[model samples]
Target: MSKLGQIGAKLHRGEVSYDFIGHRKLWFGISIALVVISLGGLFARGLALGIEFKGGVEYEAKVKVTDSTVQDFGDAVKATNAKDLGDPVVTTINDEKVRVQTKPLAQADIGTVRAAIAKEAGIPAEQVTSQQIGASWGQQIADKAILALIVFLVLVFGVIWVYFREAKASMAAIIALVHDVTITVGVYALIGFDVTPATVIGVLTILGYSLYDTVVVFDKVRENTRGITGSNRYTYSDATNLAVNQTVVRSINTTVTALLPVGAILVVGTVVLGTGPLKDLSLALFVGIAVGAYSSIFIAPSLLAVFKEREPGMQALNKRVTAKKAQLAAAAAAPVGVATVGAPAGAAARSDVQDTPRKADRATGAAPAPSSRPMKAAAAGRPQPTRKPRSKRGK
Candidate 1:
């Protein structure tokens, strides 16, 4: 096998493992910090809703774009000062076109704004085009997006609960999902990315992707923890940790594979094309996929372990496992074959005969002889018996 395959095998067999469960506090702390920062960004620098989400008028002008093109066009639109025309958002596309967005305006005001932008671009008024979006339509889209998110979350919860038959796993999966969404959204808000209908679609798509990774880990957890209460070899946390390790490599591979194309799209949309639905969608997907992979490996399994370890059965199992380990340690520390000082000679000799073969059996992993005979120890300094030479008569 290749080196990575060998490592994966070792992880599956519990030969190589990371204590994701044991170090959950650290992970939780980091997640909390990131979430706090995200929340802060959302409150301080709100999302830049696209014209699809908030009703607005858009004007496109074919012009020789320059470093100051966006600023120059934005100034021209503001100069028109048409009724209800709020601040215009100006951006460049392909270094050839300038696009401006503003609050919905009257028909006469729309022409004036379009003419102003055209004049600034040194193009004919006919060359500049305009489109108006209504506030009611935007509101409907927002409501539907919210409704879709709710339905998706409800279905995810129901499916996981039914499949795992464990409320803790379901809850953990949801928390991880929320973590992925929150981080992705927060990144968008912080970066001032436009939240369009395509962005909403991207967000919904990533929820499924995130859930998929979480479910895989949870399935492994369920498999590892089955009938665990009857065994003293591992606690619930240990099993969960093993499950995380077994699936970590797979999650990394899947996330990397998914991100490559999404990353390309994001670069093309933002750097080459200069803003479109593709950019918006790819940004959400890229952030969500990475964060989902992280939450699956760290957040979901660790939280499940925390919840499971709190149960009475798991607590009892942990105690039993701990006690068993202590007993083995004590036994290993005690001197073997040492008789009590007050013991009788016969008793001491019998103990030696019994213990010697048992120790030998343990060391060699071989079964003891079936004969009910005690092994005799050779006396110190006694001459060893030698085998007699075979006669040549048979030849």
Candidate 2:
């Protein structure tokens, strides 16, 4: 088998694993740093909202053969030097059409802007079309999106908590989901990606995905830890680690499969179609899905273990597990079958029996008592039965 295949098999069987829970503080610090940077970017640069949200005027016109190129359209529009108007964004639609968008303008200034664009493009003034947008409509949409996000979060929290029957697991999953979103949005704010309605939908869609991945890991953890307290073989944290290790391959496979299509959409939409809703939606999904898978593997279970280990019951259980582990290690390291010189034969025999594993002893609440009779009968041949011939006559 390939090296990777062997590694995956080992991980699945819990024979090999990384100490994610043991090093959780480091992961926590890294996440905090990233979040802080993202927040800084958000406040410093802010997101570049699309015209639909900010309310702007749009003008589209077909350029004449003798017209200046689309590059000169922005300069020509700015040459009008109208007051209180933001810069115009000029883009080419195909080879013949140029589109110009700008902040909201007064009714009279719209005609002036349109005429300037037409003149620069060497097109008839009537060829340029203009439309005014109101900010109130955009505000309403923004409010509704926020409301939807809140409702979604509330519902996700309830569903996860109910399914897991553990508040810490739900809380960890929620935190991971929030982490995915915060970073995704931060990327938007930092890179100045346009926040369109499609972007909002992408953000909401990722929440469910992040939750799904986290829940899968938590479910495995729950299964591994069932009846775990009855013995000292493993602690809750160890069980959690095993669960994560077992599911790592599955998570990686799922994320890769999901990301392939998203990556294609992002590339095709951005490169071929240029900036549009498709690019916006795909970019958000790509970031969110990647981060979600990462958190499910490294962050969620670690947090769950951390939260659980703090309880008194878990602490005692872990203590017992640790003590048992130490004993086993010492036993493995010690020299075997080296009876003490001058010790009584019976004492040595009893010592050997005592050193045996205590699993059956613990379960049955007693050690095996020494037997007086031979384990096998002294004679190898079967015992002969004595028959009374007189019994037939009596019958």
Name the candidate that leads on TM-score.
1
Output the number of the lDDT-best candidate.
1
Q: Relative to the unseen true structure, what is the C-alpha lDDT of residue 389 in candidate 2, on a scale of 0 to 100?
A: 90
Model 1 score (lDDT) = 0.88
Local accuracy of candidate 1 as per-residue lDDT tens digits, 199-245: 99899999999999999999999899899999999999988899999
What is candidate 2's lDDT per residue for 1-395, written digit by digit as tens? 97867888999887899877778789888888888998999999998887778898989998742234545887888888776667676666667788888888888888899999889878799989988767887788889988998888788888888888888887888888888889999999997778888999999988888888888899999999998888899899889989988888888889999999999999987776556678889999999999889888888899899898898988889899999999999878878665667864676667566656465667788976554433354564868555669858656
Candidate 1: segments with Cα more than 4 A from true spot: 59-100, 106-108, 116-129, 337-395
Question: Scored by CA lDDT, what does every candidate get?
Answer: 0.88, 0.84
For model 2, where is the 10-residue window of minimal lDDT? 371-380
